[model samples]
Target: MSNLQQQLNFVLEIDRLKAVYRQAMVKSDNNRFENSAEHSWHIALTAQILSPYAEDGVDLQRVTTMLLLHDIVEIDAGDTFAFADQTALDGQPEKELAAADRIFGLLPEQQFIEIKSLWLEFEAAQSIDAQYAKAIDRILPLLQNINNEGGSWVKHGVSKTQVIKRNQYLEKSAPKLWQFVLEQIELSVEKGWLKPE
Candidate 1:
Protein backbone atom coordinates (compact mmCIF):
# COMPACT_ATOMS: atom_id res chain seq x y z
CA MET A 1 0.00 0.00 0.00
CA SER A 2 1.04 3.62 -0.57
CA ASN A 3 2.25 5.76 2.37
CA LEU A 4 -0.89 7.90 2.18
CA GLN A 5 -3.05 4.80 2.42
CA GLN A 6 -1.05 3.52 5.35
CA GLN A 7 -1.31 6.85 7.13
CA LEU A 8 -5.00 7.01 6.44
CA ASN A 9 -5.52 3.53 7.85
CA PHE A 10 -3.60 4.42 10.96
CA VAL A 11 -5.61 7.59 11.45
CA LEU A 12 -8.83 5.67 11.01
CA GLU A 13 -7.81 3.22 13.66
CA ILE A 14 -7.85 5.98 16.26
CA ASP A 15 -11.53 6.54 15.60
CA ARG A 16 -12.10 3.58 17.88
CA LEU A 17 -10.77 5.61 20.77
CA LYS A 18 -13.22 8.41 20.01
CA ALA A 19 -15.97 5.89 20.64
CA VAL A 20 -14.47 5.47 24.11
CA TYR A 21 -15.35 8.85 25.62
CA ARG A 22 -15.33 9.53 29.36
CA GLN A 23 -17.13 12.67 30.49
CA ALA A 24 -15.16 12.89 33.74
CA MET A 25 -18.36 12.35 35.69
CA VAL A 26 -18.20 16.10 35.03
CA LYS A 27 -18.83 18.23 32.02
CA SER A 28 -17.05 20.92 30.05
CA ASP A 29 -18.39 24.48 29.60
CA ASN A 30 -20.24 23.25 26.54
CA ASN A 31 -21.56 20.44 28.75
CA ARG A 32 -20.49 17.87 26.20
CA PHE A 33 -19.01 14.48 26.83
CA GLU A 34 -15.23 14.56 26.53
CA ASN A 35 -13.88 11.65 24.55
CA SER A 36 -10.55 9.99 25.15
CA ALA A 37 -9.36 11.53 21.89
CA GLU A 38 -10.42 14.98 23.10
CA HIS A 39 -8.60 14.43 26.37
CA SER A 40 -5.45 13.44 24.47
CA TRP A 41 -5.67 16.52 22.28
CA HIS A 42 -6.02 18.82 25.25
CA ILE A 43 -3.01 17.24 26.89
CA ALA A 44 -0.96 17.58 23.72
CA LEU A 45 -1.86 21.24 23.42
CA THR A 46 -1.19 21.78 27.11
CA ALA A 47 2.18 20.08 26.78
CA GLN A 48 3.11 22.41 23.93
CA ILE A 49 1.87 25.49 25.77
CA LEU A 50 3.34 24.48 29.13
CA SER A 51 6.67 23.16 27.87
CA PRO A 52 8.45 26.34 28.83
CA TYR A 53 7.37 26.01 32.43
CA ALA A 54 8.91 22.55 32.74
CA GLU A 55 11.06 22.29 35.86
CA ASP A 56 13.88 21.09 33.62
CA GLY A 57 14.87 21.20 30.00
CA VAL A 58 12.51 19.09 27.91
CA ASP A 59 11.98 17.89 24.38
CA LEU A 60 8.59 19.36 23.51
CA GLN A 61 8.15 17.06 20.57
CA ARG A 62 8.63 13.99 22.73
CA VAL A 63 6.14 15.30 25.25
CA THR A 64 3.61 15.95 22.53
CA THR A 65 4.11 12.49 21.12
CA MET A 66 3.61 10.97 24.53
CA LEU A 67 0.42 12.94 25.12
CA LEU A 68 -1.14 11.97 21.84
CA LEU A 69 -0.38 8.27 22.02
CA HIS A 70 -0.54 7.60 25.75
CA ASP A 71 -4.22 6.90 25.83
CA ILE A 72 -4.75 5.32 22.46
CA VAL A 73 -4.84 2.18 24.52
CA GLU A 74 -7.98 3.51 26.15
CA ILE A 75 -9.59 2.52 22.90
CA ASP A 76 -9.72 -1.02 24.22
CA ALA A 77 -8.82 -0.87 27.92
CA GLY A 78 -10.93 2.08 29.07
CA ASP A 79 -9.82 4.90 31.38
CA THR A 80 -9.07 4.35 35.06
CA PHE A 81 -8.90 7.33 37.37
CA ALA A 82 -5.84 8.26 39.38
CA PHE A 83 -7.72 7.67 42.62
CA ALA A 84 -8.48 4.09 41.70
CA ASP A 85 -6.40 1.45 43.39
CA GLN A 86 -4.00 -1.04 41.76
CA THR A 87 -6.85 -3.49 41.38
CA ALA A 88 -8.21 -1.31 38.60
CA LEU A 89 -4.86 -1.16 36.80
CA ASP A 90 -4.70 -4.92 36.87
CA GLY A 91 -5.43 -6.49 33.45
CA GLN A 92 -5.19 -2.97 31.97
CA PRO A 93 -1.67 -3.56 30.76
CA GLU A 94 -2.66 -6.59 28.78
CA LYS A 95 -5.67 -4.83 27.35
CA GLU A 96 -3.67 -1.79 26.42
CA LEU A 97 -0.83 -3.77 24.95
CA ALA A 98 -3.30 -5.56 22.71
CA ALA A 99 -4.85 -2.24 21.71
CA ALA A 100 -1.47 -0.70 20.95
CA ASP A 101 -0.36 -3.67 18.91
CA ARG A 102 -3.46 -3.39 16.77
CA ILE A 103 -4.00 0.37 16.54
CA PHE A 104 -0.41 1.56 16.24
CA GLY A 105 0.45 -1.44 14.16
CA LEU A 106 -1.82 0.02 11.51
CA LEU A 107 0.89 2.50 10.61
CA PRO A 108 3.81 1.75 8.38
CA GLU A 109 6.71 -0.09 10.00
CA GLN A 110 8.74 2.93 11.09
CA GLN A 111 5.73 4.97 12.12
CA PHE A 112 4.34 2.05 14.09
CA ILE A 113 7.58 1.62 16.00
CA GLU A 114 7.82 5.33 16.72
CA ILE A 115 4.31 5.63 18.12
CA LYS A 116 4.51 2.38 20.06
CA SER A 117 7.79 3.45 21.66
CA LEU A 118 6.33 6.78 22.68
CA TRP A 119 3.28 5.07 24.14
CA LEU A 120 5.40 2.70 26.18
CA GLU A 121 7.67 5.50 27.29
CA PHE A 122 4.71 7.49 28.55
CA GLU A 123 3.41 4.45 30.40
CA ALA A 124 6.82 3.93 32.02
CA ALA A 125 7.13 7.62 32.98
CA GLN A 126 10.89 7.20 33.11
CA SER A 127 12.10 9.67 30.52
CA ILE A 128 12.17 13.39 31.26
CA ASP A 129 9.60 13.90 28.52
CA ALA A 130 7.41 11.10 29.90
CA GLN A 131 7.50 12.66 33.35
CA TYR A 132 6.26 15.99 32.06
CA ALA A 133 3.65 14.31 29.86
CA LYS A 134 2.30 12.38 32.85
CA ALA A 135 2.18 15.64 34.78
CA ILE A 136 0.07 17.23 32.07
CA ASP A 137 -2.17 14.18 32.00
CA ARG A 138 -2.87 14.41 35.74
CA ILE A 139 -3.11 18.20 35.80
CA LEU A 140 -5.80 18.43 33.14
CA PRO A 141 -8.24 16.21 35.07
CA LEU A 142 -7.68 18.24 38.22
CA LEU A 143 -8.36 21.40 36.25
CA GLN A 144 -11.50 19.88 34.81
CA ASN A 145 -12.73 18.85 38.25
CA ILE A 146 -12.05 22.31 39.59
CA ASN A 147 -13.86 23.90 36.68
CA ASN A 148 -16.86 21.60 36.87
CA GLU A 149 -17.42 22.11 40.61
CA GLY A 150 -16.13 18.88 42.08
CA GLY A 151 -17.13 16.70 39.18
CA SER A 152 -15.27 13.46 39.79
CA TRP A 153 -14.28 14.19 43.35
CA VAL A 154 -17.87 14.67 44.35
CA LYS A 155 -19.08 11.65 42.43
CA HIS A 156 -16.42 9.41 43.93
CA GLY A 157 -16.66 10.96 47.39
CA VAL A 158 -12.95 11.59 47.05
CA SER A 159 -11.44 13.42 50.00
CA LYS A 160 -8.93 16.25 49.94
CA THR A 161 -6.42 13.76 51.21
CA GLN A 162 -7.16 11.45 48.30
CA VAL A 163 -6.88 14.33 45.88
CA ILE A 164 -3.51 15.28 47.32
CA LYS A 165 -2.30 11.70 47.35
CA ARG A 166 -3.49 10.94 43.83
CA ASN A 167 -1.84 14.01 42.43
CA GLN A 168 1.24 13.95 44.63
CA TYR A 169 3.23 12.33 41.85
CA LEU A 170 3.13 15.69 40.15
CA GLU A 171 5.30 17.27 42.81
CA LYS A 172 8.27 15.01 42.23
CA SER A 173 7.77 14.85 38.47
CA ALA A 174 6.86 18.45 37.71
CA PRO A 175 7.19 20.73 40.70
CA LYS A 176 6.08 23.97 39.08
CA LEU A 177 3.03 22.48 37.46
CA TRP A 178 2.30 20.57 40.65
CA GLN A 179 2.53 23.81 42.63
CA PHE A 180 0.05 25.34 40.25
CA VAL A 181 -2.30 22.42 40.89
CA LEU A 182 -1.90 22.88 44.64
CA GLU A 183 -2.73 26.54 44.28
CA GLN A 184 -5.77 25.74 42.18
CA ILE A 185 -6.88 23.09 44.66
CA GLU A 186 -6.68 25.69 47.43
CA LEU A 187 -8.64 28.16 45.37
CA SER A 188 -11.16 25.52 44.41
CA VAL A 189 -11.71 24.62 48.04
CA GLU A 190 -12.16 28.24 48.99
CA LYS A 191 -14.63 28.73 46.15
CA GLY A 192 -16.51 25.57 47.08
CA TRP A 193 -15.56 23.69 43.97
CA LEU A 194 -14.19 21.23 46.47
CA LYS A 195 -15.73 20.29 49.76
CA PRO A 196 -13.79 21.23 52.85
CA GLU A 197 -12.84 18.57 55.37
Candidate 2:
Protein backbone atom coordinates (compact mmCIF):
# COMPACT_ATOMS: atom_id res chain seq x y z
CA MET A 1 0.00 0.00 0.00
CA SER A 2 1.00 3.61 -0.51
CA ASN A 3 2.31 5.71 2.38
CA LEU A 4 -0.86 7.82 2.35
CA GLN A 5 -2.92 4.66 2.64
CA GLN A 6 -0.81 3.56 5.57
CA GLN A 7 -1.32 6.88 7.36
CA LEU A 8 -5.04 6.80 6.71
CA ASN A 9 -5.33 3.25 7.95
CA PHE A 10 -3.51 4.15 11.15
CA VAL A 11 -5.82 7.11 11.70
CA LEU A 12 -8.86 4.92 11.17
CA GLU A 13 -7.64 2.27 13.58
CA ILE A 14 -6.82 4.80 16.29
CA ASP A 15 -10.45 5.93 16.25
CA ARG A 16 -11.16 2.81 18.26
CA LEU A 17 -9.54 4.65 21.16
CA LYS A 18 -12.89 6.37 21.60
CA ALA A 19 -14.41 3.08 22.68
CA VAL A 20 -11.92 2.53 25.50
CA TYR A 21 -13.55 4.09 28.52
CA ARG A 22 -11.28 5.08 31.39
CA GLN A 23 -12.08 4.88 35.09
CA ALA A 24 -12.27 8.64 35.52
CA MET A 25 -15.32 10.78 34.75
CA VAL A 26 -15.72 14.04 32.87
CA LYS A 27 -17.00 16.69 35.28
CA SER A 28 -18.52 18.98 32.65
CA ASP A 29 -20.57 16.21 31.08
CA ASN A 30 -22.73 15.36 34.08
CA ASN A 31 -20.08 13.03 35.48
CA ARG A 32 -19.81 10.87 32.36
CA PHE A 33 -16.98 8.34 32.30
CA GLU A 34 -14.23 9.59 30.00
CA ASN A 35 -13.00 7.65 27.01
CA SER A 36 -9.31 7.18 26.27
CA ALA A 37 -9.53 9.54 23.29
CA GLU A 38 -11.10 12.33 25.33
CA HIS A 39 -8.58 11.83 28.09
CA SER A 40 -5.74 11.99 25.58
CA TRP A 41 -7.04 15.19 24.00
CA HIS A 42 -7.59 16.81 27.36
CA ILE A 43 -4.05 16.03 28.51
CA ALA A 44 -2.55 17.35 25.29
CA LEU A 45 -4.45 20.61 25.72
CA THR A 46 -3.39 20.74 29.34
CA ALA A 47 0.25 20.32 28.36
CA GLN A 48 -0.07 23.33 26.13
CA ILE A 49 -1.73 25.45 28.77
CA LEU A 50 0.56 24.44 31.62
CA SER A 51 3.89 24.18 29.85
CA PRO A 52 5.22 27.13 31.80
CA TYR A 53 5.08 25.14 35.00
CA ALA A 54 7.03 22.20 33.67
CA GLU A 55 10.03 21.77 35.97
CA ASP A 56 12.67 21.16 33.32
CA GLY A 57 11.29 23.33 30.55
CA VAL A 58 9.96 20.70 28.20
CA ASP A 59 9.31 20.93 24.49
CA LEU A 60 5.57 21.60 24.42
CA GLN A 61 5.15 20.00 21.03
CA ARG A 62 6.82 16.80 22.14
CA VAL A 63 4.86 16.68 25.39
CA THR A 64 1.55 17.25 23.62
CA THR A 65 2.31 14.60 21.02
CA MET A 66 3.24 12.17 23.76
CA LEU A 67 0.00 12.87 25.58
CA LEU A 68 -2.07 12.48 22.43
CA LEU A 69 -0.65 9.06 21.61
CA HIS A 70 -0.06 7.71 25.10
CA ASP A 71 -3.33 5.92 25.42
CA ILE A 72 -3.74 4.67 21.88
CA VAL A 73 -2.43 1.35 23.03
CA GLU A 74 -5.53 0.97 25.16
CA ILE A 75 -7.37 0.20 21.96
CA ASP A 76 -5.79 -3.24 21.95
CA ALA A 77 -4.42 -3.81 25.46
CA GLY A 78 -7.43 -2.32 27.28
CA ASP A 79 -7.63 0.34 30.00
CA THR A 80 -6.20 -0.66 33.35
CA PHE A 81 -7.68 1.18 36.29
CA ALA A 82 -5.08 2.82 38.52
CA PHE A 83 -6.46 0.99 41.54
CA ALA A 84 -6.74 -2.42 39.97
CA ASP A 85 -4.84 -5.38 41.41
CA GLN A 86 -1.49 -6.55 40.13
CA THR A 87 -3.17 -9.59 38.62
CA ALA A 88 -5.24 -7.30 36.43
CA LEU A 89 -2.05 -5.57 35.27
CA ASP A 90 -0.04 -8.72 34.76
CA GLY A 91 1.74 -8.81 31.42
CA GLN A 92 0.22 -5.45 30.55
CA PRO A 93 3.57 -4.15 29.27
CA GLU A 94 3.76 -6.96 26.77
CA LYS A 95 0.20 -6.40 25.66
CA GLU A 96 0.81 -2.71 25.13
CA LEU A 97 4.04 -3.38 23.24
CA ALA A 98 2.16 -5.67 20.89
CA ALA A 99 -0.58 -3.11 20.44
CA ALA A 100 1.95 -0.37 19.74
CA ASP A 101 3.63 -2.54 17.16
CA ARG A 102 0.43 -3.32 15.32
CA ILE A 103 -1.03 0.17 15.53
CA PHE A 104 2.05 2.32 14.91
CA GLY A 105 3.32 -0.13 12.33
CA LEU A 106 0.33 0.90 10.26
CA LEU A 107 2.04 4.20 9.52
CA PRO A 108 4.90 4.82 7.06
CA GLU A 109 8.25 3.65 8.41
CA GLN A 110 9.49 7.10 9.37
CA GLN A 111 6.20 8.15 10.91
CA PHE A 112 5.94 4.85 12.75
CA ILE A 113 9.37 5.24 14.33
CA GLU A 114 8.75 8.81 15.39
CA ILE A 115 5.33 8.15 16.87
CA LYS A 116 6.52 5.01 18.57
CA SER A 117 9.47 6.90 19.98
CA LEU A 118 7.13 9.45 21.53
CA TRP A 119 5.06 6.65 23.00
CA LEU A 120 8.17 5.05 24.44
CA GLU A 121 9.36 8.33 25.85
CA PHE A 122 6.04 8.80 27.59
CA GLU A 123 6.22 5.30 28.92
CA ALA A 124 9.70 5.80 30.29
CA ALA A 125 8.74 9.12 31.85
CA GLN A 126 12.44 9.88 32.20
CA SER A 127 12.99 12.86 29.92
CA ILE A 128 11.89 16.37 30.91
CA ASP A 129 9.11 16.36 28.34
CA ALA A 130 7.95 12.89 29.37
CA GLN A 131 7.99 13.82 33.05
CA TYR A 132 5.87 16.88 32.44
CA ALA A 133 3.59 14.83 30.22
CA LYS A 134 3.13 12.30 33.01
CA ALA A 135 2.45 14.98 35.61
CA ILE A 136 -0.26 16.57 33.48
CA ASP A 137 -1.69 13.20 32.58
CA ARG A 138 -2.06 12.37 36.26
CA ILE A 139 -3.29 15.81 37.28
CA LEU A 140 -6.39 15.56 35.10
CA PRO A 141 -7.85 12.52 36.82
CA LEU A 142 -7.43 14.18 40.18
CA LEU A 143 -9.19 17.25 38.88
CA GLN A 144 -12.05 15.20 37.57
CA ASN A 145 -12.41 13.29 40.80
CA ILE A 146 -12.35 16.49 42.83
CA ASN A 147 -14.82 18.25 40.56
CA ASN A 148 -17.29 15.39 40.78
CA GLU A 149 -17.09 15.35 44.58
CA GLY A 150 -14.46 12.65 44.54
CA GLY A 151 -16.18 10.64 41.85
CA SER A 152 -13.89 7.66 41.37
CA TRP A 153 -12.34 7.77 44.82
CA VAL A 154 -15.79 7.58 46.40
CA LYS A 155 -17.02 4.91 44.03
CA HIS A 156 -13.98 2.68 44.36
CA GLY A 157 -13.14 3.41 47.99
CA VAL A 158 -9.75 4.68 46.93
CA SER A 159 -7.64 5.89 49.82
CA LYS A 160 -5.37 8.89 50.23
CA THR A 161 -2.37 6.64 50.66
CA GLN A 162 -3.00 4.97 47.34
CA VAL A 163 -3.40 8.30 45.61
CA ILE A 164 -0.30 9.82 47.21
CA LYS A 165 1.69 6.74 46.37
CA ARG A 166 0.64 6.81 42.76
CA ASN A 167 1.28 10.51 42.31
CA GLN A 168 4.52 11.15 44.22
CA TYR A 169 6.27 11.69 40.91
CA LEU A 170 4.34 14.92 40.60
CA GLU A 171 6.52 16.44 43.30
CA LYS A 172 9.51 16.08 41.04
CA SER A 173 7.92 17.17 37.79
CA ALA A 174 5.60 19.94 39.05
CA PRO A 175 5.73 20.73 42.72
CA LYS A 176 2.92 23.24 42.61
CA LEU A 177 0.57 20.83 40.92
CA TRP A 178 1.50 18.21 43.45
CA GLN A 179 0.68 20.60 46.26
CA PHE A 180 -2.66 21.33 44.63
CA VAL A 181 -3.41 17.63 44.47
CA LEU A 182 -2.44 17.25 48.10
CA GLU A 183 -4.83 19.99 49.09
CA GLN A 184 -7.58 18.34 47.12
CA ILE A 185 -6.92 15.06 48.82
CA GLU A 186 -7.35 16.73 52.16
CA LEU A 187 -10.60 18.25 51.00
CA SER A 188 -11.78 14.92 49.70
CA VAL A 189 -11.35 13.41 53.15
CA GLU A 190 -13.21 16.29 54.75
CA LYS A 191 -16.02 15.77 52.28
CA GLY A 192 -16.19 12.10 53.25
CA TRP A 193 -15.14 10.97 49.81
CA LEU A 194 -11.82 9.51 50.92
CA LYS A 195 -11.00 7.69 54.13
CA PRO A 196 -9.28 9.90 56.68
CA GLU A 197 -6.67 7.30 57.45
| Local distance difference test values of all predictions, in order | 0.79, 0.88
Q: Kindly provide the TM-score of model 1 when superposed on the true structure, using C-alpha atoms.
A: 0.86
List where candidate 1 sits over 4 angstroms from the true fold: 23-30, 187-197
- Going through the candidates in order, what is the number of backbone clashes in each? 0, 0
Total backbone clashes of candidate 1, pairs 3 or more residues apart or in separate chains: 0
Candidate 2 residue runs with Cα over 4 Å from true position: none
Q: Report the C-alpha displacement of residue 162, candidate 2, in angstroms.
A: 1.2
TM-score of each: 0.86, 0.95
Q: What root-mean-square deviation over C-alphas does model 2 reach?
A: 1.3
User: What value of lDDT does candidate 2 attain over all alpha carbons?
Assistant: 0.88
User: Lowest-lDDT window of 10 residues in candidate 1?
Assistant: 23-32
lDDT per residue for candidate 1 within 72-168, as digits (tens), equals: 8887788876667789878888998998998888888999898898889888877778888888888888888887777877767666666776676
